[model samples]
Target: MKLLFLLFLVINGAHAATHSLKYFYTATSGIPNFPEFVTVGLVDGLPISYYDSKIRRETPRQDWMAETEGPEYWDQQTQVSIGSEQTFKANIDIGKQRFNQSGGVHTVQWMYGCEWDEETGATDGYDQDGYDGEDFISLDLKNLRYIAPVQQAVITKHKWDQNRAQLENRKHYLTQECIDWLKKYVDYGKSTLKRTVLPSVSLLQKSPSSPVTCHATGFYPRSVMVFWRRDGDQVYEDVEHGEVLHNEDGTFQNSVHLTVKPEDLDSGRYECVVQLSGVQEDFVTKLERSVVKTNHGNTGRTNPGAEGSGSSGLIIGAVVAVLLLVAIVCGVVIWKKKKNAKKGFAPANTSDDGSNSSNNTAPKA
Candidate 1:
């Protein structure tokens, strides 16, 4: 599985008010030491709550969510997730039968979410399902039908589409109920969600001839852009943009590498620019040999703002954490199918790295 996450785009302007609420449900079979079912709920790209078969309970991941919600809320959510767990377990069996697989590791995923633009009063909702790391079916809200990408999913699409009541209920939940909950969450966590923390940028390299890497860490909201600029213009060629990773303390980190010739490095015309959400000022780091820290013996100079010699270790740890997540995920036969899908569904070439109440109804597959 090529696990990748582009959680949210960088929302520009100080008054930008776009928020999203998403739920990811994964059910697996034949995975040792791992939960058979897992659920993650994110609001504006930050995990707010989590549930798993091992825990048998839905718990808050964010302090604001825990503090704002009471026991009754969690109890209700736990029950909702419990019901979903049962449905997904059966769904897995159905998927296996459809794929004609008798045994081995397998996974079934359901992604449903909604996005709201507070400033413009626009709302959108999506629901999608995947079997064995491939797109299966998704709900088309406009037409009120199910779209089946692969032939195996045709029966399921027909079955689910015929249930107009369930379709309407899902549509109402996604468009109306989901947005209401998102607004409440945004209100409850406004203090923490609205807060901004500036990033600490650094320049690092392993050798003089190696590419210069610009690393930014300790930022919040998880929406930021890092790029290499040469002579006041953005440099796209020979530049690699790294994924945004979560820090231990809930902040985020990102990196960009620029391969430059020795002569170009000497010119000092290149700089790294970081643009963070809701921030007016841009963080810039000049590309100078003196400012670049290298691991080559004692010739390197450390940036006071950086984590000193341990900076490389921190970067390595972040990358390893991402790899470990990918490694632990249950393996399945990668399916290749193409079909038009809704918001929660990804394209055929890409697979998503894979919930609650009454606003508490169990999801029906």
Candidate 2:
């Protein structure tokens, strides 16, 4: 298996339907004005293969982004990426104008992420707003509660009472739109895209190549089911099911792994099944014992059996934290030294390393 991870079920709790809708908005300006643009992403648990904003249309999407965003023409970029240089420049000018007219901060920022896991559950979300690098407002979507920027204060202390209901209704409206969009996308995928991108299955084994994995990719709707079978019967003991993963092209990939004993490798008895709508027949792949090649890395993003087991996400988060810390420290040191130098004083650590001569006591950049 490329991504070697054993599933450990601490609590076999009932699972809610995996569904999420994320939205991100950003506005900035160099001209002392601010203009805002909004974009939303809809997914039925995971990414889909096609693009249709009207969602119910058998006809293809007509947005400029739709031409290269469909299953057949998509690049690596996902739907979450929706900004452009032309729009960015326009937004900067708009933001500058807004700032000048509104008589406030030089910049404005807004962002929100919303998710609904259970089919019947309420949508939960996080929202933030800022102006001129300072927090303007923040919200917790799950409880419809407001987060005060100051300590020992109720939301009323922030004047939210004046517009809380209206603001909350806006959040609800956004969530409902996402749900509607997701429903249409799911229907479209099952009825249309599912038949377009055929599943390509690969059997992979790591360097020493012991446990073989049946990997499936280029599928849609997030309704795929994959499992391992032995001699025409589903095997439960040595089988592990992966999560539905979002591919770069807005399609999805998944894998189910089986750890076969050395003696069973050559038996040619292991098979994997991938099922989806519009598939008249199931796509099955048999693990070839003689050719179970070494798996160098991940087969795209594999589904981990358990929730919150994102190795890649965690690693990226940690690396980002470290880099941010280093950058902040470097910025502070540079700012302080420059400020002090302007007052005719060198930094305390500006000693010459090679010699202690007075001539060598000149400033160092």
Candidate 3:
């Protein structure tokens, strides 16, 4: 009986030793195209026996574990011892898992198990709710997440702000340019006003009746003023000036009509003057009329013979002047002929006496 008891004790001790909880933990670089292996240790005093670990890409919903597994998923196991109490270590080899394209975070988790209730030999309920092994080893692994849309939004806002600033600067520059152009136009208009020419003045008509009416016109804007001065004094009550007429292009024209008797027309000079605004130019014109002549009745006396004798004497005098001119011309011709005859005829000369010296010397010799 004592030997059997001792053998039973050894068998129970061996089973107890095999039934202790097991634990393992691991970390990995969870880049999408490249995955690296890492080992982590869980220190606990209990002797761990079994271990299970997995690495996978995370999903959008929580119930993804019940669906069909993807190409990248966690691998779990419960029948191996990774390491011991002082230095428990695990190395997880996760094939390439794409985290960025998967649209979420990637993670790795470790699970450990032990034999619970050996009397009934039940395989289920070996691990606690939140515990992995004797000391509750856990690891959280995540990958880099992409948030490029937010950064793009910030860049777009900056660009819009810069564009708005440039537009405002352009508008201000154009406004200043328009203002300068308007000022130049105003200055040009002022100079043109100063250099404009005045209109020419002339007399149109004069009246000899009781009211002497004269008509005149002007071309400048403010050049229509009509007044009459009698002996250097202004007369305004009896004289009335007409309204000015404006042309299509904003120039002025006017006419003055005055009434004065023939006596007043012969009195003094009436002056019409025109003035311009921008420049100091004044045009003055003076007008007057001559007095009329009158003829009275007269008696005439007749002298028939005297008139006839005067006419006959004029005719005789004209004939005598013609005859005298002819006689003068005939006398000039006779004198010329006599001078030629004297030259042509030879003179009679004597040899010793002075009578026929030319004939004697030519023939006798």
Candidate 4:
């Protein structure tokens, strides 16, 4: 019984103190062999559901979600995504007209989410829209108004702000309905969501002159802090932090780089520290020459390919990285054809129609 109690604590004790549920809706034009409209729902940075115009059906991405939800739930979500698809398609067209563009490659994205702080019982929500990788409009829940960053979106801001019913519905959905759903999801995936996994830390060096990199991978919950310390004090100068990237197994990885003189590197004063949320212990690695993993050879040079193979790059798939959302959306705009489009825009050779007009649904009241 005592061992059973401890086992329960190990499995269910360390949940994410703060949890978030986010939905990303992306609509693109002039992209070849890609979904024109795509929607992804994430809970605590893990993908829960995915929908694309090609599939036309909402599918569960998480095992817990798949086991917990019935066909009716998926069907309802599919219908909602279909409605959102039409809305986003029209929105992108309107945005193009507002920008005074005839035809080109463009993108419109909507990111909305709710965050819950478990300890404090506090909840927050946000709804933001971006066009061409720039902020267009965002909701100010405090004032119940929409803020337009660019002049092209001022019309949309004014129109959305004035509709009191729309404002109320959005607020209620984000704060109340969204929170309810988020809680249900947490409960459904408690076993997996509550478990904590520590990261495997490594110190990698390409060459003697190159900066030393401290890499941490295979961690869970996605909230981790990694930094360099010199003689037990945190080092800020000459340290560069990399973005947290998703591993293929749903774990996360990140790296921090530190540049120091060869003498300083040999002094053994620097150490790397990793702090994972919900875990009390700090994983530390001392900067010792023998302990550092290096590809340096007799000529004090490292193989570029061998060194680069261990580095994390942009992960592409249905499970989107929070930090790489903009990069993924903007970087894929490779020109298949070029026309007399604007300087920043890519030319389009394909029709932009993604859905039938008859199936298009009006925005919810």
Instruction: Give each model's whole-structure lDDT.
Output: 0.69, 0.43, 0.28, 0.68
Give one digit per residue, the lDDT tens place, for model 1 in 1-53: 01211211232222336788877777889878888887777777577887788
RMSD of each: 7.0, 18.9, 70.1, 11.0
Best by TM-score: 1
| Candidate 4 displacement at residue 185 in angstroms | 0.5
Better TM-score candidate (2, 4): 4
Over 4 Å off, model 3: 1-194, 210-218, 247-251, 278-281, 290-365
Q: TM-scores, in order shown? A: 0.81, 0.41, 0.25, 0.79
Ten contiguous residues with the weakest lDDT in model 4 = 336-345
Q: Which residue runs does candidate 4 get wrong by more than 4 Å? A: 1-15, 297-365
lDDT top scorer:
1
Error of 3 at 354 (Å): 99
| lDDT agreement of model 3 with the native | 0.28
- Model 4, range 1-365, lDDT digits (tens) per residue? 34643443343233468777876778888778877887777788677887789889989889999999899878767776776777778777888888998777888877777878888889988877787767778889888998887999887766666667656767776777778788888888888777777877767878888998888777787778888899998877788777566776777777889998878767989989988888899988888776666765322211222233333322232234543354334322221100001110111112133212232232311
Q: State, as a TM-score between 0 and 1, how close model 2 is to the true structure.
A: 0.41
Q: Where's the lowest-lDDT run of ten residues in candidate 1?
A: 345-354
- lDDT (Cα, tens digit) per residue for candidate 3, span 116-226: 222453332111101111111111111111112223223322332334433232233223332332233223333222234454343333223434332223244333344
Q: Positional deviation of 203 in candidate 1, in angstroms?
A: 1.9
